[model samples]
Target: MSLVKKSLAKTASVVPSSTETHAPTAAIDVAQANAPVTENEQKEYPFFVAAIESDLAQLKTFTDIADKASYKSEALKRNDYLGYIKRYRLSGQNHHNTVLAWVFIWLVDLKRWDDVLELLPLMVEQKQPLPTVFNTKHWPAFVIDQLYDDANYYLSQSEQAGLFTISFVLHRLITTVKNQDWTGLEVVGGKLYAMAAKVDASLHNYGFAAAFAEQALAINEGAGVKGLLKDLQKLLKQSEPEQAVDAD
Candidate 1:
């Protein structure tokens, strides 16, 4: 599908199903539909479409309508991309997670971290997971508390998938440390240990020269790192820690 079409597809998922099945009054260009998809297509689809094609303009309107509709979960299940579709549509009764996930992906992709904070409260109102950025110093304590409240809510739903990249988590960790959120050091300490254990042990050969290590420890007095080591020590055989003892 075209980038615009695909994004519209996701956006359509959120629009109320009862709305007119056509484009809103907005004029869209047919020629733009023929534009190359090389740029947005090369990567995995972003959570939001950047521009709407003329043909798909009506679809965007439908999505806005769907966002306001009240639909039964069963009705939503009939759609192909149920998660995406249910996000913007339905009355306050919907509990879909797609909207929050898409919003996070969208904001992160746009590098609009501040705006993300603004949208986060709405997500919380809907009982969704908060983005992990607040776990670090990039945002204020009030923001972190709000984000953590949401994280705990989602964490109760399932053990975090543990699928986030160590680098992504570490980058945010530094932000938390920069903001003097000492508590973040402990929270991220476990994630670092988990990442180190899963990553190639060759990382130890580089010792602390690893980019993530430098970024995380730049502000920390190695205490956070030492805690990380202690966690890794529990997971590894004694000999591995012995070999790396000099590295510290």
Candidate 2:
């Protein structure tokens, strides 16, 4: 067997299946029965948590993006544990899974946009919490903040291609989080809308740009979109066909 299969087999022997249940013969047993995490999860959670902590500590040592990317590449090679955890969660089991959370964050950091999008809906459905290091209460807000920061970074570098790439993911994220309220939604969400507007404006898609800018302004007056909106409106007006004057 491969190393991953071997580790999984060993762990499986110790971890109880989700369907396994014990008759509560005492008060302690009753309390155990009511515990949120299954025996399987309790057994498996720590291994993944320890792995995530080690990865985070190692990641802190790298300053350059290339170094961090290389570290992530190496770390992802040992991520077979995630498959087991994902299966557990997808089987209607709900508990804090730091492994899944970190994987999502790392995927975002790596700019694996499609993978991130694929995982986002499941995370939202499971109501996954961000890791404590992020100090964010909700995952949706954290995602928007990350994407907004990415947009600004690309804009600062005058890298339109980067912005264009990020815009697609940003739009999908916005759609996913639409009507979802979280802490700092007005600020971060508004900024995201503003970023989308700016991107569309850069591409001369003035109509969509105006709409996004309006949404940003509506969400947060300080979203810094009023100037952009005015410019977009003027351009839209200039694009309108002038009236043909009849013979006087």
Q: Which has the greatest TM-score?
A: 2
Q: State the lDDT of candidate 1 residue by residue for 158-211, as single tens digits.
A: 434322333233335334444343455544443343333223122342333233
- Least accurate 10 contiguous residues by lDDT in model 1: 68-77
Provide the global lDDT of candidate 2 against the true structure: 0.73
Tens-place lDDT digits, model 2, residues 1-248? 32333444676734223243553366755555455655665565566676677788989998999999888866766645445554554345676677788888888887777777778877888888887777776666667777878888887887888877877887787787776663456887688789899887877778988999998888899999999999999988876654223222
Each candidate structure's count of clashing pairs: 16, 0
Q: Which segments of candidate 2 are over 4 A away from where they belong?
A: 1-6, 11-46, 60-64, 182-184, 242-248
lDDT of 2 at 237: 81
The CA lDDT at 108 in model 2 is 80
C-alpha positional error of residue 29 in candidate 2 after TM-score superposition, expressed in Å: 34
Q: Mark the 10 consecutive residues where model 2 has the least summed lDDT.
A: 15-24
